[model samples]
Target chain A: MVRVTELTNLAVDLVDVHKTYRKTVQALRGVNVQVRRGEIFGLLGPNGAGKSTLVKIMMTVVRPDKLVGTILGRPLGNRKKLALIGYLPENHRFPPYLTGEELLDYYGALAKVPKAMRRRRAAELLEWVAMSKWAKTCVGEYSKGMMQRLGLVQALLNDPQLLVLDEPTDGLDPAGRRAVRELLLRLRSEGKTIFLNSHLLSELEMVCDRVSILVNGLVARQGTLRELTEHTVEYRITTTGDLAAVKEAVERCGARIDNTVIILNGHNVAKVNELIDLLRGKGVLIESVVPHRFSLEEVFMETLGTAR
Target chain B: MQFCALIVDSLRHALDRKLFWILVAITVLVTLMMLSIGFEGGKVSLFFGLVEAEVDSYDPLAASGKARLVGVVIYGLMDFFLGWVGITLVIIATAGLFPAMMESGVIDVVLSKPISRPVLFLYKYLASMVFVLIQAVLFVGFTFLVMGLRWGVWVPGYLLCIPLLVLLFSYVYCVSVLVAVLTRSTLAVILISLGAWVVFSGVRQAPAIFDTFPELQKHHVTHQVVRAVSWIPPKTADVTYLAAKWSNAGTSLDIIPASAMEDVSAAERGQLERSNQWEKEQLEISAFSSIGSSLLFEVFVVLLAMWKFTRMDF
Candidate 1:
């Protein structure tokens, strides 16, 4: 039994969603997720980990074996709810005969945008994606990266409250990747919820405020990066003095000295502070103290290994 | 709105496809060839001399069987080649319309919008029907035009055949769409459609196959069997039959009633009245079996396609 919530607060919520293709290949196994308003939520997973499958279930592109979900507080497959959401699939292909502008207009029209509004939005989206010059070019003539950008533009055409993207930046270059990141951030700033699935963990780390990682059709870990990685602590300490004294003080404070450096592991902030205080008392000048940010890749690998 | 958008997009895509143009060209060329063989001023003879002209077995009674010969030739050509072309062109064009779009991932983009599955299916089917109607009308109309030019007069009844042709061909297109949904491979769809076409058209011609089922051995049973196999092609045969009936009516032989043929130039008004009554009765019967079957088949196929399309995943 799923509880009904206020529409204005939650962008997307799925409880015990299950999807099996052809009565086999259980792509989603009781996956639960909730994306709050105005946050870029990343659905991170490897190939065949049900990333796209989950997105498809949410968008109603494919029916779920069992879907207990809601979008914007409305039940899934509700047309009124769908009008407020835009989706870009992993492999976004449009009718090759249609030009970029025409394709956008077609989707915009399908989304129930007025004719005048569709045309205006198509132009604005094309310009925003930096494909205004190629607006008239047929989609088949566009490169893979250009098609990806166009797909992103189409996804944004309706000014949807929630944007669902699967592998949105799969074929993008560095510059294109940066542009997409900025676009998502801007949308987030404008109070839009972005639900994204990507293989690029670094980009997810940069853009996503929260993320969920799935393994073998189940969510292995999910939370803000700060919450998930906070349990592991790493510190950088610089001090000028006799290295032997600093090392001795670090060892005395229950810290390990590695390569002439004092290292503190785990959530024992008291031990790190003790070492710092001892070094200061020894008249060893301290330069800087910084905590290393944990990369999502490392966290993901660790999570996957633990799940296995 | 979603349905309308889908229809517009489908129409645009269909118009832009190279296959559409190729089909149009082939239809025009075939119509021209049929026209050049001039429907009027053509002789229909049943016998040919084998070696030297040493008294061939042609009796004067069988010499001028022009109407039946023309009917057989026209129906045969329409059924075998032109009808096949129409069905094949439709299958090829619409075979990949939805299935290929799904396989190529384009359907995801479409479905991601606010469109409903049923609406998408309806609109695409409508678009395909419209295309079929346009192509079929053009083919039949231009053929009629060339026919009028060569024969020095246009047969008004030929225009009546347009709806029949459109209905039959649209049904085939609908079936192709359903087959496409069932198997999302264009090659497989073509093969299956062609096989179905062959089974419906050629299988009934074999006595053994018809004899296996006692129910199909009745008078109109073969028609029903053929209709069950592939409903559209036989409808084309029916349309051709109606057109032939109309063309035959314009001839002098058709003016004389079977009863009045013995007493030539006697009781002209009575013969004309009786002939008109008999023609009306024959027409009513033809319309029931031929035209009615075509209409029913089209409606059935359309509904079936819509149902399947709505239930399909993509």
Candidate 2:
């Protein structure tokens, strides 16, 4: 397990990737995403926002009309470098004919793992995924959640430096989702970079170190969870005073008064202090001040609502 | 190493389908039928009413027919059965291969691997060839044994069937891969490839038919048109015909079709000889020129298919 700190600084640094399919239908438009080492980065977008296409470009599975990127410090599409990256496609369909163990072996061999290592790793992965009992069962017999677990095993087979999972928990049950979330965090802890593409907001909120919201072939918002949600916040101030004086002082201080509460519009601490002083000067005591920050889901909605 | 894995994985892919086992079973059944052929008397006895009465009167097996000629007879029988029927069944079993492998959700997993797209494409094409190989081995191996033990004539030329059948299937499979890449529909690949095969076979034989009838010739130069048409596609039918020629070690002229040799007058026999001479010249391409020409055409189509496949987004 190689930690990102132990390696180079960036796992993925892509710039201005534009993909136009068949001379029409532009799928990606000048998208730039920089993923730090050992971080779980979430890519959230509505359907057809090109999140999968972006990952495909990084994995060298999709040929972009114009591409500028380095994956794991190597130029995109470098065959040797791709061995250091693992990808699980959205709605992935592994060959139904292969047994669970055979599926791992097949992908492990593709990843150029040695025979002994592949055998040992396949067993270890199956056991880790709690799928050892079903190792010999044909994949067609596995449930959707089971397939997702097996897919994750395949993605990890190479002990990749960067793991890209498209809709990783799309078909998983609650427990399965929780397990995958924990597994992703563990991978991050091991210093492996993760690029997760999914539409599930809460899942991303819970696990991702940083996130990017994409809409209409463009990046709508991108930053750490705190960075995205902390700017321009609405502060809730509770006060015990006459409503009219509170409203006048609140209006004078440039904040909206929602009944007894003063809702400050800006994230500026100076304005909050000024408003609190005004309330104190008016002989009204401030009961409490609780800063309200938006959740990632709200940021995602606000980001995509621009497309309307 | 990854290339080998893709090939082995694809073989498993073929084996997973019931179509593969069914084709193997049919090959075994046909081999038994070929083995049931008895020659207790000077007259031939074919079991299960395959040709109970007609095979007896066939001049190819007349008392005057030489023992080496028996190899030619067997060559014709095996070539017509294995070459034509066997190759057709193989195409039916395999035409959907590239399309099925390239199915949307499926192909992404393979394309994402470290292997180069062109290498993967070509290897999977070879993997689809595996389905035919198993049948070819069983069919030719059993037929070789029965031909040697029952007929007492061991023609090593029988070994050419395996490679030749592979070439024939490959010739048509290029079309399958191209269409599968373009459309990703197994039914389309099967219909279009088999349809192209029908057109190629139809064109290859049309010249012979046009040359046979003076009435058809009087309408126009049909054989000339057929020759022009035949020059385009890989000469698949001729590849099979060349396999029959190779089966006889290139020494024997094609035996006249049994129906054409029935009660022939001397004057008509002379005409038959002239016709057979023209036919012999048509089929007399050197083994190198024969297989090589078709293979070059297959290569051209496969290259085009690979180009599209590598550039493809999925």
**TM-score of every candidate's chain A:** 0.89, 0.93
Clash-forming residue pairs, model 2:
none
Interface RMSD of 2: 1.3
- Each candidate's fnat, listed in order, reads 0.73, 0.77
What lDDT tens digits, residue by residue, belong to model 2 across residues B1-314?
77677777867877877777877787677667756675554545577335554344545555344454556655655566666676667676776678777776777777777888898888888877877777777777877887688756677877888877777788888998899999988788878888988887786677666666566777576557776776678777776567667776343446476477678997688668767866577557676775677788889999999999988887
Instruction: Put down candidate 1 lDDT per residue, A1-308, tens digits, no spaces.
Output: 32446445778889898887788788999999989999999998877888888888888777888877678888887787788888888877778888988888788888888889888888888888889999999998999999999988888888899999988888999999999999999999999999999899999999999999998789999999888788765777766545675676577666775554666766667777887788778887777777775689988988888878
The most accurate candidate by DockQ is 2
Question: TM-score of each model's B chain?
Answer: 0.63, 0.82
The segments of candidate 1 whose C-alpha lies over 4 angstroms from its true place after superposition are A1-8, A239-254, A278-287, B30-81, B148-151, B203-236, B242-314
DockQ of each: 0.62, 0.72
Worst 10 residues of 2 chain A by lDDT: A1-10
